[model samples]
Target: MNEQVIVTGASGFVGRCIVKALLVRGVGVRLLVRDPARAAALFPARGVELVEIEDLFTASVETLQTALAGGGMLVHAAWYAEPGQYLDSTRNLVCLTGSLHLAEAFVAAGGRRFVGVGSCAEYDPTPGHLGIHTPLRPQTLYGACKASTYQVLEQLLPGAGVEFAWCRPFYLYGEGEDPRRLVAYLHARLAAGLPVDLGSGEQVRDYLDVERAGEMIAEVALGGRCGAFNICSGRGQSVRQIAERVADGYGRRDLLRFGARPDNPQDPPCIIGVLEET
Candidate 1:
């Protein structure tokens, strides 16, 4: 395999971590981003190349081919993930089409491996441990798009002689996480000594540190792993537990206001992934 890896969404939260992990391994990296200046600032180091594109959704086939050329692996992590609007965003259709185009271009350009980041939402939200074999019944546009990509590419790429893997990540929290996300919101509220409004606090979820998740993603890209893998901690923890943990860290558990906010009726009571050791 070629030592160079091409990564889309290299400036996003999870993408940045994956880039860092690959760089630490002394792998040559080519980053595709809409903003070259921002990616440069974020990853200013040796062995990394930045390729600026106006938008992946509208990027030309030639542009994708150029970025993917001679790379051993292509990690497609870019997608529209705006805090409040992404779940049902129409942009997901654009992502699905664009990502599929990129995958096709990568395979034609001799890329040996293709790894795309999926979401736990792609699985049916029944309360149980989700595995790679779990039936995919995505609930939202975002999940549907991811599941669609996995279904198409899992069959398309390998037939074209390109190794394919889809990584489904559970709740992720760490540096660069959006402030509107659960962990960041809780941490911010607790640190300010303010009451943190929460729901019933009984919804169980699988949370994984973003850094570890990135490492696992990088390993999948560099290794010979194929098919779907869950990037998660495997263990389940309630929303209340996570809030309490953050509050405790801030020395303000008393400030936690469970039941202050109403729970989303669509949210599954429990959604955890079955562990897949790297």
Candidate 2:
């Protein structure tokens, strides 16, 4: 707990939560961020070491190693996660390449443990309830790249004497959520007492608060656990169910219009996570 843990993307929504969780546990943290001022305002506390990286996905291995040197643990939560484009973006390739460099740097720095964040999309979507054993059938470029990263690091890190863990989050939502996402959109509409448009609202998913997801990821970093971990709620709720619950908070169920919009044909009917016992 005393050793410094280096966290990339420490200013991101999930990364912010991860850093906060580590800090709450009294762990020293060094943030790899582009904006040190933003990170400073976010943390505003002692024991946070901020190192500015212009672009993590493009940084050289040596540059990364210099920043990572002397760190005992690394939480790699950085990626090209622009809300709408990330799923199909060619930037995923860049991220994949950069992640490899980052892993190499971690190893070069003699880091003891490396924990990386992943996505549920890495699994085959046909399984409504995905377990760690689920076959990887990433349908989108983003998923494919994430699966690729996990597979590569899974083999490479352990062989290099570095403990590795991958935390795959499913349907995380909460503070700092992208406004275009489901929970945020619902809140925006309901708060304004405006009609909220949606699809059939029948797709079931495993949703977890980002804060709790961060806590779980931090636990993996702090403990001796290895392999893939699903950071999810382990319970499936229909989209309609989630919408209604959000509406109830604003006393505006009338504002929800379930069939106002057409559903994405590609969206899976159900995607839930089965927490892996680690």
Top model number, lDDT? 2
Identify the leading candidate in terms of TM-score.
Answer: 2
lDDT of 1: 0.90
Q: What is the C-alpha lDDT of each candidate?
A: 0.90, 0.93
lDDT tens string, model 2, 27-127?
Answer: 99999999999999999978999999999989888789899989889999998888888999999999999999999989988899999999999999997
Clashes (candidate 2): 0
Worst 10 residues of 1 by lDDT: 1-10
lDDT string, candidate 1, 170-210, tens digits: 99999999999999998887778788888999999999999
Clashing pairs in model 1, backbone N/Cα/C closer than 3 A: none
